[model samples]
Target chain A: MIDRLTAFVDRLRQVGVPVSTSEVIDASTALSFISWSERSVFRSALAATLIKNGTHRPVFETLFDIYFPQMVGELQQEPDSEQPSSKNDAKPLDDMTSEVLEALLRMDLELLDRLAEEAIARYAGMMPGRPVGGRYYQWKVEQALDMNAITERLTQMLGGSGPGGETAGSVLTALLAREDATARMGELRRRIERIIRGRLISDRGPEAMARALSRPLPEEVEFLQATSEDLAEMKRTIAAMSRRLAARLAYKHHRTKRGRIDFRKTIRRSLETGGTPLEPKYRHRTNRPDLIVMCDVSGSVASFSRFALSLLYALSQHFRKIRSFAFVDAIDEVTHFFEQAEMEEAARRVRTEANVVWLDGHSDYGHAFSQFLQRYGDALSPKTTVLVLGDARSNFRDPLAERLHEIRDRVRKLYFLNPEPHRHWDTGDSIVSKYSPVCDGVFEVRNLRQLAQFIERIG
Target chain B: MFESPDRVTAALKKGGYLSDAEIATSVFVADSIGKPLLIEGPAGVGKTELAKCLAEALPARLIRLQCYEGLDESKALYEWNYRKQLLRIQADENKDWSKTEEDIFSEDYLLGRPLLDAIRSSDPVLLLIDEVDRLDLEAEALMLEVLSDWQVSIPEFGVIRAQRRPWVVLTSNATRELSEALKRRCVFLALEYPSIEREKEILMTKVPDMPEALAERVAEVVRAVRNLELKKSPSIAESIDWARSLIALGRDSLEDGEIAETLGVLLKHSVDIDKARGALTAK
Candidate 1:
């Protein structure tokens, strides 16, 4: 049991979930207390001990299903006792099956899809016993469809000049003429494989399916193209990163600074050593600089804004005060929104209700800067650090370089985070170069790694 | 020590804390192995309540150390009573210097903090270190040392091992990530908001005088409010308070206007209250 638990932990670690040795021991101990027969109870026990962050729950569940499969017991109830005899049924080649074969032979992808569902269901039932894996099941289904034979039939039809063969010949000829026939074949193979895999998942469970569909590393996933699930996973990663950053900052401050020396205590200690002075202490300073975050929450850079705001919000405790603003063409003071709601909720509300996006639906950095200077300019001081997150694409409008320069002069530092790659920054509508000259630092933060490096440098 | 998870559940329930199978299993395992249990969750999910309940169930002395920023070993573990030591040194001035010095640094001059007290206690102890995430990394390191070894190493008096292994429960709101070293030395339990059914039971138990329908309505509303993106969702404790408030007002079922009026009992922030009000009105 310990070995199994350790192995499961190892898998979790492989999938980027950090699990300590003590956690492994705790999970094993926790397992001993639960009735192992109750799978949900057992799963929850291990999960509570193994998973520290909520984001890791999905990965942990996937790994759990893989390591401790409940399918073996489940499959026994409805055992596939029938032998693998393709010729046992009189209508062995059902109407849908024959149509699928015919469509494959004729290179009719549309018709093939129409019949593929029924064909897959029939093929799944015929395959006795638990599937070895998704890939093997895919291969079995492909073999049952006889893809090679269909390819050969198509080739033969293309080679012939017989009656009714001309139509098939033209279709096969057109398919062969395409430069991406191999790619098309690969797509078709994948589609069939998905059908087979989907059916197998219902029988065995989603664990095998999830294992087959690998996810990109959290730090590597691009923000703009990320799905909601990826965004959620990134949020967890950001949360963990922020916690570590806070701890690091606290440790640094704790190590570098000392509390004020107690003169009375020093004198009292001196009495023990005959008026010898030693062990001086200095006051612990809790002073943190004010932070002002200006984010671009327009269509192009919303993901980056969300992530940056969340990270900043998580570290809000470390700062004296953090005022956040979101803008496209207009600016809205979202500091209160963030302060009033949780990070997730605040981000959502900012998107929906902050009214940062103008009716024109185009990002106007010049307008946003002028608005910020007009309304919240007094809030800036020499002690404040202004952080801006945007792609700097202002739709060919006036580049508000001078307004930013004025704000930069008032603030201690102005750091701009551009989600676009550096190569594309100066091109198109992006006026990053215009603002880069006036800003203290312009970091091309395309992913979390760059974001982390930038954050560390600033800290 | 719990013989099974069910026994742990029964004991905790009898102590007025409705625990699920996972919590029961974790508590039982921590007791059986004599290791500390680290409970982490969002704020007000009863991470601290679990410790209190376990202490009540075990019928042991509950020694609590509420952690915060700048929490040091002197405050959490042990501190030498310097003034007492100094006075004793002055009083023993005529005596041999080394003898007096040694005497002043002994256990008599050592003021035991929560950790030291739990370790030295002969009675069964449930040491609840609340909000462990608030402690600085240095303080956390100090705690890790004592928790892992079940002993504190004082330079003058040497190591003081626990007479009996205390049932330690460290709770964190996850404001910060705890060090792996501290986490590894304990059993881990992640407590979340209870399900509606479990929460209803909790509301009823915590507010027995409240009507059953009112309790169910409070649980349902609290559940709905939690689902909304609120700044601070009503915790189980707040749900009980909400139920009690409703009972005090002579209301058996939640009314439309009253929900808007009484949302303050459940939600702390005005923004959250507004959001909950909007959601309730929309429903």
Candidate 2:
């Protein structure tokens, strides 16, 4: 049990869950108090001790299923001679359709489990040492079961004459029954999937299953490579991340603002308080830097620019003054879009509403920089920090490094954020080296983690 | 003090908190292993109520420390009573300075906050740190020593160890991520909104006067509203409050009119109420 626990901890850490040594000890200690007979409690014990963050819970649950499965092999039910013919093991596939419908209608979980196991055994082609992904097995089982027909039959049985000849009360009853049927179908599907997953994990040692199944965390997913689902999840976390960033930035500012206590003031105040020195004063620090962000919203780096602008817009409360501009070959300020609507809406509006494109819509960094400096030259000051977000691919245009140098001279700090890989910096029309000398910092931020680290460093 | 997860479940049920086996198992393990339990979830899923229920189940004295931004050690852990110390110094004028210093820093002049009070209590103590994620990182760091070693050390004074280890339960709405070192020492329980059946059972337990059918209906409607993408979903507490309000208004069954009328009890936000109303009517 200890060996298995340690190995599971290793799997968790492999999947980016930071489980410390003390937590491992706590988990082992927690395991001793619970009975292994109670599987839910056993799993809960490990989860409580091992997992902390809520986002990591899904990964932990997946790894937990692979490590500590409920049943090892074909689950053995109690043998009953009285009802042998009706048993799932003896029943043929022809009778299974009705049996499955009946089991689903009754919501008999054990019967569904047995049916799922039997269906996988016959249909999933689960031979020893067979190398196949778990989803293929699940798809096979799903195909064999004809789940759509079963659901249609179940709905027909549940709907009861199609609610045509029903009263208001019976209509409500049918609606509730249909809802229950949909829930049961969902449960049936989940059970089949779990059974297939368990069979594969047992066949292909858990290490390989862990490798095949583990997904990159939302923060680790590259902005350029993110799916729509990943982008939605990232959007959901952006608000919370921004709130945390604001808190951390405010805390750091407060800490710096609290300078060392003045002994002279303390002594002066102590004269009135019988030399007790009860009240003390400190030197107050000042100045919050202004920020101006320019994002290149060309096709290649559009997603990266969207995320950067969304994060900055969400965190606009922390900055003293923040102005955001979106550009392709032309530059236009889109800060008002953020103020009028939410972050996602603002991102969408920046594309459709902002007049950013001029001539062909390839990313012409030289043209955009010159346009920005021409239009907003007076906006830059010594207390301002400017961040340019793009891949700096000038598309064989003039490699205008001097305009960036002029912008840098007017600002306290100038930084460039390139979403492309570091190795891909100066390839082809990429002119990052020309701008690197003028910029204070040029960071390669391909994913959310690096973006957050960069912001924390500069904030 | 819970012998098994089953016992924890039954005790919590009796204490009027209907928890599933998972929550029961976590509470039991935290108790037996002498580790603090960290309960995190969305707002109003009963994370804070879990700590109160555990206190009631154990019949222990509940020492609550409500955490917020800028809540530091002097407010949470302990602080020296400066006025009392000053009086002691004034009273013992011309006495030996070392003895006076030692006399003022003792237990009489030391003010014990909730954290220290829970540690120094003679009886069994259940320390409930409510909304712990609201605490600043420095204040959270201050709790690591007390949470891990069951002791607090002041530089001027010696280490104040726990007389009997308190069962610590920290609740977070997860507004901010907690430090890794603080989380490493504890057991974590992520409490979500209860399922429909569980919510029905919760309604029955929390408001016994409501009819079983009506409780089931209320749970189903709340679950449906929760499925909608709204600003704030109705929490378990809101469900109970809605149920109690239904009974108070003398409504036995949940007609569409009844739900529409009392939607305010379940949903706090106007936007959520409007969305839930549209969904409920369409259903």
Candidate 3:
């Protein structure tokens, strides 16, 4: 049992959940106290022992389910059942499996999908028990389907079929032209694996499935394509991140640096030691930089704006002042909304009630910049850090890059967070290339990882 | 020590605290292994109350240290009674200065704070450090040595080890992340708001005079308020207060006016009250 527990902890650490040695010992001790017959009790006991941060709970639960599948009342068959059947091993591919191969040879994706599902079900059901270590059923089903033969046949058929044999023939040739047959087969294999994993999750438990499905690494999930649920999870992760950042800042703030000595304090301390200057006090400076955040709240980068605002609001205590503005074609100062409401509510109101969207509902970086300069330019100072979040997509309009440069000159530091990938920069109406040179830093923040790195630099 | 999680649950229930198995398991494990348990959750989720109940269940002395900004070793662990030392020095002016200084800096002149007090106690102790996240990093760093070793070092005396290791509980609202060095030395438990059924039982247990229907209504309203995006959701204690207020007012069920008038007991902020009023009225 101790070996099993330690191995489970190892699996958790492998998946990026930091389970310390002390926690593993605690979990081992906890396991002995709880009734192993009650799965929920056992699971919760382990969770309480191993998981310190709530964000890591999903990863811990995933590893727990994978390691302790018997707790969920699945995969309990004898170990020998996992071995290949002697009769099936002696025989070649069956007729139904050949039919799937035939469909794949014709590049009949529709027919192949149906036949693949049937073949997977038939082979997976025939498996005596769940495979350990690797995905046994998926590999077995793939081998049985003989996708290599289908690929070989398709290569030959497409080579002879010229450009006008049929729509399917042309589609196969076109697909092969874009990607080699080997790569296409690899993609098909991945699709089959996904199906098999889905089935396994359903058979194991829905609770595990729910956690596993949404447990994408926070840095890897693209903000643009995240669903509302994914956004919520991301928000939770970011909240944890901001708390960590705040703690670090607080730690740094508490470490009083040795500045110019205070002669008066030193003289006063000399009195206690009978005119011997024993202790000296130094003057320390507290740098609380004012922040001015201007986020583009148009449809394209609204998610990024919301996420960044939420994170900044979490770390609001570190700054002396934070003034926020949202813009599309016109700019609107939404700092009051944040002061009047909670962070989430303020972000929502800024998105809906602010006059960021103009009549055409197109991003006008030039108009927005000119308005900000005209209205709130006086707010910028040498102690202020200006953060501009957007894709810099100006719809072929004047970008007013000069106005950004002017703002940059007034502020102590100016940062540009472009949510679009760097490869997309300078493409279409994105004027990042024009604006990048003026800012202190222009970061490609397509996902949370880059955003966190940018914040760490500024923070 | 509690024999098992079930025994801990039974003991806590006997002490009038309804604890789930997870909390029971955490308390049991912390007691058995002699590690501190770190409980973090939103405010008003009974994180502190769990400590109080554990003390009762263990029938031990409770030593609480409320943490805030600028908490330091002098306040948390120990401090020298400088005034007493000064008086003693004046009285012993004829003695050698070095000997007098050594005598005054001894344990007799030391004031044991909660941390030191818990360690020095002969009886079993439950040390509850409330809102630990509010402490600055320096203070938290000071705690690492004492908590990890169950002892305190005074330069005047020597290391003061605990005669009986106190079961420790640290609660946080997560205002800031705790250092990993602090977190790793403890078992962690997160206490969210209970389910409606479990909450109804809690309400009935705490407010026995209230009608069942009224308890159900209160739990329902609290659940609904929790679902809304409020600055602070009504905690279980607030729910009990609201229920008791309704019973005190000679009401058997909720009326819109009564809920409106007594909403302040549940919702702390005006913005949350306004939002809850809109939600309640809509309902």
Candidate 4:
């Protein structure tokens, strides 16, 4: 049994999840409390046993569901059946599962697994969903059949208008070419069509039953850009390394002085000085960066501000000065966030501290641009490099194209990194189409990989 | 010690450069501190190679522990030699049944796996704990005590401490983030994909038979193709493969014309091949 559990986990590893041994112990301990006589309950119990944190809860639940699927009758509205009930309509999802289970129990095990899958899939398709324009008639016909063997009852209900008015069987035959694994999956998939509920997973992704048999979630983290301090440190380190002279620097040039001066350096310096009486001056050097950065940490783009701070922290040693600011409806200097004892805490304080009336959390770039013009347009000189990270969605407010036009004149380069996809640029409050024109460079950065490329390009 | 990012790149320029960086250099430090090194990287980025190379550098025997899900101390440490135990049991069956249980559980019956094998070996060994991510948390936690002490406890043997604590190297593709408890015990190194220049150097070195110009073109094509939205990008191994495939085919320049069927050389996934094919023909 331990070996079986071990094999079970080994399979989970074969997928993407990393399971440690303590979790296995916790799962086994949890399993001891359950009665395996009931498979669904036992499955839930095993999940309860193995998984510890809330973060891993969904993953464990998914794995559990995949491993020990409830048989048709087993999935009935008993105490622990995993049949998901819609908040609106409570009862009887798997009438077919129970019907097939009742029909198949004590029958052939292989046949039971097969037909139950078919009937369960069919039942799954009829599960509640929003009205698809074409599927309404099919749903209605199915609803009729479900209501009063409505396939048969439709004739009387229709007052003999037309007998051939899309029978359920003909509708099924006409639509979705349902056959073999495609038919099975098509049925299963239609049953588990993606929820519009705005969540990462619904019970609909592929191999749900297989994923459910395990303990917890898979690992997926992308590290494209470092936290701001780390980025800053990398920048600083790179700068410091740059000055060492990859091959050689003529630092020890000879100097030939008047009366018995240095021999080697005296002669070398004399050559540069036409072998005249000259002195060799030694100046120690380390690589460093000479540049200016204009960062926009406005509340609209606050999600990345934390990382920006870390970058600033890392580069604190390399640069002479870094001029940073935050804006909501308006731009305000908030470089003090990096200077503060706690960067996150400071950002919070700044958010509250500078809650000026114009600076709204929801974006208003027109006002922000106008404020930049009146307040600090002179600061965006040609030597400065401006990096703006935001959705560029100004919420249907004025696009304020003229102000960006003026600021573009002052800054040497303006780079834009929008988190939103390119297609969504002109959709709603998005000023991406308008803003893309003024910026020197524009790139979509939805993940770390893109961000790393962006940083490398800029650096 | 890896001072410049360029130095790291330069280090990776050679052929057989394993992408085996841990969570931080702490793993490197721990290895230097004479503790076991736990290295976790994706499947093909060469976690095992780091140990192999390090073993070569150190000139020590590489003792590897291949971890599976249900890995236990009995398997990782020492297990009773059942054939020997059974032979003894049969031999002692008629002599004295009373002392049979104790006699059968003696050290003579114990057989050593990698963990115990590393401990008992007179010479220094590189104990590679490959794919630590596959093992459950309990196994990881159990590993902590041994990792710190360089010893294993067996009731039969009383305690089997390392005669010469082997250099332990653990690897993972990050199926899960290791616990802080386990992490604190080791040094770290986070391996990332190499840059274009470094990758080019790697290609030239790994496939020395490859034409230099062809290798450069391949690296460029790989980088450019990688820039597009594909299912998965070509890894370092894939770069080597594409070079080898090209070399075997006796092709030097990657003509725009050759990309259609030769896309299988670049893209691994069918969808990616189709996407690349579409892009190649798009203009």
Best by DockQ: 2
Writing each residue's lDDT as its tens digit, candidate 2 over B1-283 gives: 8899999999998889989988999899999999999998878889888889889999899999998765778789898887778778888999999999998889888889998998889899899999998886788998998898988887778888999999999998776778889898889998889988899998998897879999888887777676655556788988999999999989897766677888999888775677567656645
Q: i-RMS values of the candidates, in order?
A: 14.9, 5.1, 14.2, 26.6
Give TM per candidate.
Answer: 0.72, 0.80, 0.71, 0.38
Question: What docking tier does model 1 reach?
Answer: incorrect
lDDT per residue (tens digit) for residues A1-459 in model 2: 898899999988877789999899999998888888877888889889988876677788888888888776543232222233344455667687778888997889899988876677667766657777787888888898898887766766765644244423443344454565677799999898777777677667788898898898766888877776777777646655665554544443433436788788888867655677876756555556677889888888867776777666666633547788988888999877865454567788988999898998988888888999999888999978888989999898987889999999999889998889999989998999999999999998887668667755665
Q: Comparing candidate 3 with candidate 4, which one achieves the higher TM-score? A: 3
Tens digits of lDDT, candidate 1, B215-282: 76677667767766544678888888888888888888775678888888888877678767765654
Native contacts present in each candidate (fraction)? 0.23, 0.49, 0.31, 0.00
Cα lDDT tens digits for candidate 4, A74-135: 33332113233332343354454444333332334455444433333333333433223213
Point out the higher-scoring one by TM-score: 1 or 2. Answer: 2
* Shift in Å, residue A417, candidate 3: 5.2
- Give the per-residue Cα lDDT of candidate 3 at B267: 89
Name model 4 segments beyond 4 Å from true.
Answer: A1-459, B1-15, B18-28, B97-102, B227-230, B279-283
Alpha-carbon runs more than 4 Å astray in model 2: A75-102, A121-128, A143-185, A229-239, A246-277, A280-298, A301-358, A364-419, A429-459, B249-262, B274-283
What CA root-mean-square deviation does each model show from the true structure?
A: 14.0, 5.9, 14.4, 29.4
Tell me the deviation in Å of residue B113 in model 3: 2.0
lDDT of 3 by residue, A66-142 (tens): 55654233333322343345335433456665565466556677776655555565565533234331257777776
Assess each model's interface with DockQ, reporting 2 decimals per model. Answer: 0.20, 0.39, 0.22, 0.01
